[model samples]
Target: MSKAFSAIDEDREVDRDAFTPGVEPQPTWCPGCGDFGVLKALKGAMAELGKDPEEILLATGIGCSGKLNSYFDSYGFHTIHGRSLPVARAAKLANHDLEVVAAGGDGDGYGIGGNHFMHTARENHDITYIVFNNEVFGLTKGQTSPTSPKGHKSKTQPHGSAKSPIRPLSLSMTSGASYVARTAAVNPNQAKDILVEAIQHDGFAHVDFLTQCPTWNKDAKQYVPYVDVQESDEYDFDVTDRREAQELMTETEEALYDGTVLTGRYYQDEQRPSYQAEKQSRGDMPEEPVAKRYFDDDYEWERSFDVIDRHK
Candidate 1:
């Protein structure tokens, strides 16, 4: 662990209220907004894990979901549109002891930041990525987002969108995310449980969170009566089996558009080493946090100008 985070490792019983800022800013979200559920569940999950706010980092992208950093009392970075993952990845690589989480809306994550989403999962970065999948772009006046259902009408697509929605769970699994799951804001219990597991996971954990946009997506199903795959006997499949997970994910994705919301852990591969672990195993990364080395006064450090002059 890095010297920077050595103090954070001290064990202490954490309270959920500890995450709330001293000056609580009332959320600006519209009435019945699902973002409130996310905040509550996240706080609950962190409290359950007994993680200190100083030990966690929250990186968010542009959109209503980006406001997560404002509400979450943690080390936070509000990055540009669709860039939360890259920033979170850098932080994790610099200080491996920090628990990193990246969050954004569907438009920001699956649309503008789709490449980052794919590559980050492909590289198996050790971070929890939460995509608030509300179908429409809630912050931008309800435009048809990447996860918008086929033929879904919006301000941008008054005649209804012609494109099919992206299957985030299947895509994450295919791209090598070691842990993948879907949860809804309406199901606070499930959401909290999933978040706790995701945070504790040692590999890339992708959570496709179904957030209802009551103001914009009034037509959206409230994600009620969500069937938990792990709890339901009707849907039995090995979470460790890639083929089984893929098949279930396909069915779940298709069912979402049809009004059935299936939510739970679809895949988990605990044996796969995370990117940071792989680098350390290969002796490419130092055991200490990279951030610590930069402040070493006694160590010789090369300046950028000196390197440029040498090259010249």
Candidate 2:
């Protein structure tokens, strides 16, 4: 999918509209799709952070979320299924200055992409990962996803799902993500704020965004009147407390199926050094961006490519 692409100038003052493509293509996601909320919140977060479109790299996998790069005006890669994290990690490694983000659906991220998600978090990579958790494979015509509720009925499992849903927040916390959050599409303000914090975070930040699929999974409960863990007087837990966060996340994950949707930032670790920073501190990573070296030696690399071709 490599092709010549142009970038927006860096010196221009960052505006919300700067992220919109010059020739904007209308999103094909179904009307009332929760994806629209994500797009809006993301644009708002980027604008708030004063991030130029050229300074960010958005990597997406094969799912409805993959179309994000097409609509958002940024340096992007539409990677293969379950591969967005690897691509995002590579981009971050090559240029620490680039803001890297990976987005995918629950099926794409928690199923086949589960391994990458685990290791990336374990390594504390410097990137923001957004998993659109709508409870089904929206792009594959509403199949049961890894996060689908137990006993949920789908075409793939007309008898209902026999397996329990994987606890995303618990998994993320246990897997070593430095920053963890859960936000819903129904709450755009909170979503934007969480995204802003996630992007600014230096270590791996995993946001399990609860999106609604109106066309599919009609049996799901309406996601409204959610309680923000941060704003609610009923729930009190320190955001920096891992054990407390784990307990709260368990309840939050369970409540989703019990007709209560809880949304908010649950955990954050500020002292942990990111994978890049740790490597650079040990003199393992280059002082300057590796991309600069690649560009400067482009002609020599091309000659080497020709030499390999002759051997073949």
Candidate 3:
């Protein structure tokens, strides 16, 4: 069998509208929901890159953010809460040619699936991970989430949440994500640009997207008047420098709670090799992807019965 199944049609021009499902089901997200911004930026990025919907695989975890796959016209898996990363990692390893992107809310990504997020970054998996940081758990009726600022009152914390919020960008860098960035739903242009860079990165990329929950978290900032670190003269740091990135990320995290919304690429390590490439270099993984073998009708497949007989 030919490898035509994985080939990209470079001759064709891809449109942003192509990613929108033909039978557009009316979106159920509430009016002024920041989730809509994520969808728009994602589609714009894919279209700008000239990527066909067939070439991409989007995996999402449970929460309001999980509905992203439903709106995006691409191969998708809506996995259990906090499990999108692992599923996305498996799919990427199976078919290295597929453009893998994982998304989830703060509670899903930072609370439940945090371990997977850290390890995936540490291993430098070639995947883009977008976390919708809306502070509270929107789908579950405004409960305190892992990213919720300290003292922020929610249904789960009626008086106030004493616990501090996770510094996502700094944590991602320390855990070993090659590309670390922060973008807000309020700034679609910057979000699209960052998404483009994240998708193009060869190693693990983590984007802490600040999405406001207008309906659930009334106290949450809409993330307006955001200053892009790259554009602002007030902020200056090298994205390739670990120490610089760390300092800036810490500042950004602190500033968010203090009413300053700073958004931009924080770190990128171009020299680091992705997990798949490292495995291949060590002769551990096959040159031909596992996905391709499944499509080959003539390829031999070992049977469970044969293994049992051999063991016996």
Candidate 4:
């Protein structure tokens, strides 16, 4: 185990309320917003794992999801649009001990920020990334989001969107996420359990969180009466096998627009090393926190100019 997780006191009991902001302001998200479920599940998962709030770092991009850190009370960075992943990556690189998480809406993550999403997964950064997919941009007055269904009308696409929705689970798997799963607001218990596992996972964990936007996405199909593939005998596939998981993900993505909401773990690679792990193995990364090196007066560090002078 890395020093990050090994430092935690397993017997310590962390209260869920410890995550609440000092002001304890209620979330400003629209009533019945799917984001509420995510917040609850996160708090529950952290508490269940006995993680201290101080050890966590939540980085969120522009949109309603960015408000998460305000309510989560963790070390937070409310970043610019479609840039949470890079920001989160920098933090993890500087201080690998922090349990980092990045969050954003579908439009923020899958649309404008898609490039970052792909590379971050390909590198297998050690962080949890949650994409709140509501099909429309609720905070921006109900525009078509990246996950919006074909023929789904919005202010931006008044005649209805012609673009096929991005297959997030498939994309995550293809881009090289070590862990991938889908969960919904309607299933809080399952969501909580998944979050716990995702946070516990050692590599890049991507969760396509289905969130309902009642005000903006009233046209969205209700996520109720969902099927859990893990518990259902009808669906049996090993999460560790790439071939099996790939086929299952393809079906699940198609089933979503067809009105069948399939939510569950799709794939995991416990053997894959994370980006930091690879760097450490190559001797390119320091075993201790890079931030800590600044405080060590005895530590000699090479300057950028020194390397340039040597080469000249």
Put down candidate 2 lDDT per residue, 179-204, tens digits, no spaces: 99999888999999999999999999
Local distance difference test, candidate 2: 0.89
The 0-to-1 C-alpha lDDT of every candidate, in the order given, reads 0.91, 0.89, 0.91, 0.91
What tens digits encode model 1's per-residue C-alpha lDDT throughout 1-312? 443476567777889998998788888888888888888989999999888888899999999999998988888999999999999999999989888999999999999999999999999999999999999999988999999999999889999999999989998999889999999999999999999999999989999999999999977768887899999999989999999999999999999988899999999999999999999998767798877776677777667675444543
TM-scores for all candidates?
0.94, 0.91, 0.95, 0.94
Better of 1 and 2 by lDDT: 1
Q: Is candidate 2 or candidate 4 better by TM-score?
A: 4
Residue 300 miss distance in model 4 (angstroms): 4.2
Q: What RMSD value applies to candidate 1?
A: 2.8
lDDT computed for candidate 4:
0.91
Q: Give the clashing residue pairs of candidate 2, or none.
A: none
lDDT of 1 at 186: 96
* Candidate 1 clashing pairs, residues 3+ apart or interchain: none
Candidate 1 deviant stretches above 4 angstroms: 1-4, 294-312
Candidate 3 deviant stretches above 4 angstroms: 1-4, 9-11, 302-312
Write candidate 3's Cα lDDT for 1-312 as tens digits.
433345454556789999999888788788888999999999999998889888899999999999999999989999999999999999999888889999999999999999999999999999999999998899988999998889998778989999999888888999999999999999999999999999999999999999988999877759877999999999888989999999999999999888889999999999999999999998767877788887788999867675344543
How high is the lDDT of residue 299 in model 1? 71
